[model samples]
Target: MIYDLIVLLRQNPTAEVCHKSIQFLFVMNVIALAAVQAMLILRVWYLFSDQKWIQYSMILCFVACNVLSLYFTIMASQNLKLLNGTIFDLGKHGCRASRPPNFYRMFMPSLGLHTMLYALTAIRALRNRQIFSHAPVLKRLIRDGGLFFFVVFATVTFTAVGSFLTQLPRINITVIYSNYLLSLTSIAMSRIMFSIHSLASNLGSSTEWLLSNVELSRVGWRKGRNENEIIVERRCAGPDDEDYYYDDHSVLDIGGGRDDDIELAHVDGVKVRRSYDTSRSKSPMPRLTESRVGVYDDLTW
Candidate 1:
C-alpha cells in the first residue's frame, strides 16, 4: 500500500489523493499500534492470572491508550493538507501531514502503557523468581517481555521526538518516520509473542513432568489392608475427613520388603519392584496396613 501510494503521488499530485493517503496511513498505523498494545496486555494478563484487579487495571490502561490514539489520529486526519498549500507540488515521493497542535497527545498514553506493563512484568518476575528458578523457559519469558517493553518504549520516545521535530521548517517527514516506528513496534510485539509460544511448546513436556512431580509430592499415601490396594490421602485437609482418603485399586509393590513401602519417589529415585511368578500357586502377601507417616509429606520441596 505504501509503494502504491508513492507511485500515485508521483503520477498525479492532487489534494484529494494526498488527503486520502494520509488518512489511510493514519488508520493503518493506529490499528498496528493497537494490536501491539493488545498483545502486551495479553501477556500481562497471563502473567498475573486470576488477579482481577491487576487484569482490570491493565485493560483500563489499554483502552484509554487506544481511545486517546484514535482521538488524536482523527484530529490529525482532519488537519491534514498538502505542504505549502499547493496541491500540485505536495511531494514527488509522498505526502506529509500538516502538523496538528496536539499531535503528540495521541502517543503519550502508549508510552505510559508500555511503562506500566514493564513495571508489572518486572514485579512478577521478582516475586516468582524462586518458584521458577529451575525453569529456564519462564525466565526467558520474563527477559523477553522486558526486552520488548524497552523496544516499544524506545520507539514511542522516538515518535514523540519526531512529532516535536515536525515543528521545524526543514523537518517535513515526521509522518513517515512515525509510521515506520509504529510498524516496527507492531513487528517487535508480534515477534516477542511468537518466541514465547515457541519456547512454551518446546518446554511443554518438561513442565508437565514438573507439575506431576509437585502433585505427587503434595499427596500422602498409606498401605491398604488388601495388598493389591493402596490408600491415597491428600496432605491438605479436604472439606470433610471422609473425603481425605480414597482407595487406589492399582497394584503398586514398593521394594518386595515385608514392611517397606514407597511414598513419593523422585523421577530418578523410583525402584522397580521384583516380578513374581504368577503361574505358581503362591500364597497372598501379608496385608501391611501401616501408615507411611511423614514419608510423602516431606517430599514437598
Candidate 2:
C-alpha cells in the first residue's frame, strides 16, 4: 500500500508506473483471496464429523472457485483498460478503469465463496449453540469464525460493489476500495489465526471436563488418565443402545477409540490419536465372544 501510494500517486506518474501498479494489485488480490478461502475452508472442515459428502463437496467447491478466480484474474488484467485521466483524472488516488470485457469477474469467485462459507460456518455454529458457552473449542470456532467471515464478506463485497460502481460512467471509487481489498484480506486471515492459537493455549483447564462428561454426538474428544487408554464413555441416547462392554484388547486400543474413534482436531489442523503399547500391559485384556457395540472404520482425515 505504501509502495502503491509512493508509485501511483506521483505528480508525474509514468505509464510504466501505472501498468505495474495495476498488475500488482490484481496479483496481490488473487493471492489474498485464495489465502482467505483456504483458511475459511479449513475452519469449516473441523466442524464436520465423518460426513464425507459435506467435506468432499466443500473441497470441490474450494478448488473450483480458486481455479475460476485465477483464470478471471488473468483475463481481467489483460482486458484492463487504464485511462491516464488527463484522460479527466480522479486526482492522485487513481482513475476509472474502462472495462472492454468481463473485468468484474476477477473478484466474483471470492465474493461467492465468502458468502457460501459464511453461511456454512454460521449454520454449524448455530447447531452447536446449546453447548457454545461450555465448549471452549466450539466457542472459539463460532466467535473467531464469525468475525473472520464477517470481515472477509464485507471486504470482498465492498471490492465487488466498487468494481460494479466503476462500471458506471460517473463513479470513480475503484482505487480506494481496491486498496482496502488487497490489505484487509491478508490482515484479517493472519490475525484471526493468531487469536485462535492464543485461545487454544488457554483452553486446557476448561477442556478436560467437557471431553469426558459429554456424549459422542455433542462432544468431540475424551482423554484418559493414563497414556495406555483413551476412555471414550458413551451415554447412549437411542432406545436400541444397550450396555455392551467388550473385553477384547482391540476395543481399548488407543488409536482413537476402538473402531469408532472420536477424532480430535486442534484448531490449527494438528490431528492426534494417542498410541498405546498393549504389549506392556501387566494384565492383558481378555478377548470377548459377543458385543452389541457397532464397529466401523476410523474417521478419515
Candidate 3:
C-alpha cells in the first residue's frame, strides 16, 4: 500500500518543483555543514590555550569522522549507480535511485558529528569554570551539562522526527531539518565561545591593571616616607684680623626630627641636648627651655 501510494504520487510528481526544493535544501545543508565545521574547529583551537594534547585529540576525531563520512558518501553514490543507474539525479533522468547519499550517508555522519561537537563544547565549558573558580561541582555540572543536554536533546528530537515522518523515497526531510538544527547549534556555540573569550580578555586586563596599581602605590609610598640622612654644608668666616674661613658639614636624619618637641624626648640611644654646636664666635649659646628655646639660662636646673 505504501509503495502504491508512492507510485501514485510519482505518476504526477512535479520534477521542476522537486528539483528546486532539493536544490534549496542542498544549498542550505551545505552552508549549515560548513558553519558547523567552522564552529567546531574554532572550539578546538580554544581548547589549545590550556590543553594542546586534548585539542589535538579532538581534531583527530573530527577529521576521522569527516574522512569516513566522505568515504561513505562516495560509496553510497556508487551504490546508487549500481542499483538505480545514475549518481547525479537532479530529476527525471536520476529519479529512480533508491536513496541518495544525503539520506543514509551524509545524514548519518552528521549525527555523530553534532553529538561529538556538542559534547566537547560542554566539556570545555565545564573545564574552564572548574579552573577559574571554586564553585561547587554540582553547580557547574548543572550549568554546563544542562545546557548540553538541552541542545543535544533538541537536535536529536528534531532530526528523529523529521527523518521518521519525512517523504523518504522522494525527500530526505531529516537532512533538511538536521541542517536547521545544526545551524542553530552552531550559532549558539559560536556566540558562547566568543562571549567566553571576551570575558577572559577583560578579566586579564583588569587583573593586570590592579597589579600595576599596587606596585605603583608601593613605590610611591617608599619614595615619600622613607627616612634618609641628608648632609648640609656651611661656610663661616671666623672673626680675626686676617682673613680666616672654615667649612662645616653636618648630617641630619630627615625623618629623625619630631613634629613636636614631646615626640623628640627619646632619640634611640642618644640623650637630648639643646644644641650640638658650642662655638661662641658663630653665635651666643642658646639656653634650652621646655616651651621656648634660648628663653632661660638654666631651665633644666
Candidate 4:
C-alpha cells in the first residue's frame, strides 16, 4: 500500500490523489500506532491482573487514545497540505507534505498514550522489583515493555517536533517523516513480538518461571488420606521431576513401615501434599486415617 500510494502520487500528481493519500496515511498510521499502544497496555494489564483499578484505568486510557486518534485523523487530513502547494516534481523523485504549525496535534495522542503506558510499567516494576530475581520472565517483560514505550514515545516526539521545522537550503529534512515513522513503528512492534513468540514456545521447559506466577492450592494437591500425620519434605522440583520423593525408598517403605504421609514442595518452595496408607489391608476396617496432633490448619503460600 505504501509503495502504491507513492507511485500513484508520482504518476498522477492530481489534487484528488494527494488528498486521498493523506487520508489513507492518517488511517493506516492511526491503526498501527493504536496496535502498538494496545500491546503495551496489555503488558501492564497482565502484570497487575489482580488489581481491578489498574486494569480499568488502562482500559479507559486505551479507549481515550483511540477516540483522540480518530478525531485527529480528521483534523490532520483537513489541515495538512502538499509542500509549496504543488505535486511531486518528477525530477525531484518524490513529493513533500507541508504541515500546518499546529500539525503536531495529530500525534499528541500517541505521545500522551505512550507516556501513560511507560509510567504504568515503571510503577509496576518498582512495586515488584524484589521478585525480579525469582521471576526472570516477568523481569524481561517489564524491561521489554519499557523499551517499547520509549521507542514509540521517541517516534511520536520526533514527528511532533519536526512539524515546527521547515525546508533548509533546498532540502526538507522532515519531508516524508510520516513514512519513516510508520516503518519504524512496524519494525519495532514485529521484532518485540517475535522475541516473545520464541520465549513462549520454550515455556514447557521453564518450570521455575511458571511456578513463580502459578497459584497452587495446598489443600487441593493433597491426594490421599485427609487425616494423615503428614511430614513436610521440601524439594525444589515438582512431582514430574526426577528429584521428587518417588524415587527414594526411604520416603516410601516397600520392605517395612508404611506410615508415609508426605508433603512435597513446589519448585518455588510452596508445599502441596500427597499421602498413601500402604497397610490399609492389614486393619480390620482398613484405610486407617492417621491424624497429626496439634497441627490442624493448612499452610499458606
Candidate 5:
C-alpha cells in the first residue's frame, strides 16, 4: 500500500505538486529562519554582554530582518508557482515552478544580511580577545555566528548564481559545480575559525591564572620582607668609675644571632660610645669634614 502511494505521489502533475511542496517548504524555511535568529541572540549575548548598545542593536536587526525577509520569501515563492501554472508552458503538465526574479530580490537582501553577520562575528572574535581568553562563552558565540553565516550565505549565493548560469549552452562543469565549491569553502573556514577560537580561549584562561598567582606570590613576599626587618629595644650597662650607667635601646632582628661588645664610654653622664662585632655593626665611624664647592676635578695620566 505504501509503495503504491509513493509511486502515485511521484507520478503527480508537476505544477500542482510543486505548489503544495512550496507551501511546506516555505513553512520549513521560516522555521529555519527562526533558528538563525536564535543563533544571533546567543551570539549577541556572548559578544556584547558588556556593551548594552550593541546588544540592543542586535535585537533590533534580528527582528527587522526576520520580519521583512520571511514575508518576502513566502510571497515570492507563491507568486512563482502561480506564474508557472498560468503563464509559462501551460499545456505541458509537469512541475515547471522554477526560480523567480522576485525571489531573487527578496533573497538577495537576506544574503547580504548574512554576509554582514559573518563579517561582524569575525570582527567581534578578533576584537574580544580578552573575553575569549577569560571565558568559553564568547568563543562559542563567535563560532556559532560564523558557521551560521557561512552556511546560509553560501547555500543561497551558490544556488542562485550557479542555477542561473547553468542555463548557458556550453558552460564548464566548474561553473555548474560552483555552488558546491563555495559550500566546501565556507565549511572549511568555519572549522578553522572554531579551532582558532578554542585555542584562544585556552590561552586566555592560562594567562589569567598565571597573573593571579603572581600577584598572590608578590603579596606574600612583601609581608615576608616586613617580617625580616624588625626593630627591638634593649638596655645595656655602660662602663664608668664605680658607677652603673645605662644606654638607650638598639634595633635588632629577632631571628638573627650576633655577638655584641659590652664595653662602653661615658660623656655628659650618658654612654656615648660602644663597640660590636663588625659582622653585626650597625653604626658608621665618625670622620673629620671640610667643605668645598664649585670644583670640577679631573685626573689624566
Candidate 6:
C-alpha cells in the first residue's frame, strides 16, 4: 500500500518501474491464490479422509487452473502497455495498463476452482448429513470453507465480468481486493484446521472415560485404582464362586475391537455384547475406533 501510494505520488514515473510493479503484483497474486487453493485441497482431502479419487480430482483441478492462469498471464504480459490516464491507471499520477482488455479473464480459472471446492464441500456435507449433523467439526469445516469460497467467488466473478465489460477501474480495484481475499481464505483455513485438531483431542480424551468406565460398568465391573485394571463380578453368580479375576495390565484398545472376544453384559437392564482388545502400546492417549456400537449404546467406543 505504501508502494502504491509512492507510485501514485510520483510524477512521470518510468514505464519500467510501473511494469515491474505490475509484474510483482501479478506474481504475488498468483502465488497467494495457489497457496489458498492448496490449503483448500488439503481441507477437502481431510474431509474425505484422503480418498484417492477425490484427492486426485482436486489435484487435477489445481493443475488445470494453474495451466490456464499461466497461459492468460503470459498473453496479458505480452500485450501489456503503459498509458497516461486516471481512469484505468494503477496510479493517479502516470501508471496504467494501456492494452489487454481481456486481462481479467486470467482470474476466471481461480474463480472456477473456488466454486469447485465450495461444491465439493457442500456435497460432502449433504452426503454425510447424518455424520456432519452430529459432528461440530464437520459442520464448521463446511461453514468455513463455504464462507471463504463465497467471498473469493464473488470477487473473482465481479472481476471477470468487469474485465469482459472493459471496466478497467473495477478491474483495478478488484485486483487488489483479490489479494486481500486470498489472505482471508488462508486465515480461515488455518482456523478450521486448528479447530479440528482441538476437537479431535477433546473427543479422544472424553471418549476414553466412556470406553473404560461406562462400557465396563455394563459388565458389572468397576475401574480399579490403577488405570490398567478393572474388577469384574457376575451379578447372578455368588461372590465366593464368582471370578474376581481380570488382566491386571489390560490396557483398553480403542481401535477396531477384537471381533472374536465378545463379552455379553446387562447394560441398563438390556443385554449387550461388545468386543474390546487389549493394547500393548505404552502411549495412554486413546485411539480412534472403527467399530460401531449398538443402537442402545452411546458409541462403540
User: Which candidate's TM-score is highest?
Assistant: 1
lDDT of 2 by residue, 36-69 (tens): 6787887777676456787788889888888888
Per-residue C-alpha lDDT of model 6 across residues 29-144, encoded as one tens digit per residue: 67767877787787787677637888888899999998888778777776677675555555447467654656777888988887888888888877887755344455666777
Which lDDT tens digits does candidate 4 get at residues 252-273? 1111123445534232232334
Q: Which runs in model 6 stand beyond 4 Å of their true positions? A: 1-12, 84-94, 167-301
Clashing pairs in 5: 14-95, 133-204
For TM-score, candidate 1 versus 4, the one ahead is 1
| Count of clashing pairs, candidate 2 | 0
Best-fitting candidate, scored by lDDT: 1
Please give the lDDT score at residue 233 for candidate 6: 40
lDDT against the true structure, per candidate, is: 0.61, 0.60, 0.44, 0.57, 0.47, 0.60
Range of the 10 consecutive residues with the lowest summed lDDT in candidate 5: 288-297
Over the stretch 98-171, how does candidate 5's per-residue lDDT look in tens digits?
45434444445456656666777778878877755334444555666576567766766754454355354233
TM-score of each: 0.63, 0.60, 0.40, 0.62, 0.45, 0.59
Global CA lDDT computed for model 6: 0.60
Model 2: lowest-lDDT 10 consecutive positions: 246-255
Candidate 4 versus the native: TM-score?
A: 0.62
TM-score winner, 1 or 3: 1
Off by over 4 Å in 1: 1-10, 84-97, 134-137, 166-172, 175-178, 204-301
Instruction: Return the clash pairs for model 1, or none.
Output: none
Return whichever of 1 and 6 wins on TM-score: 1
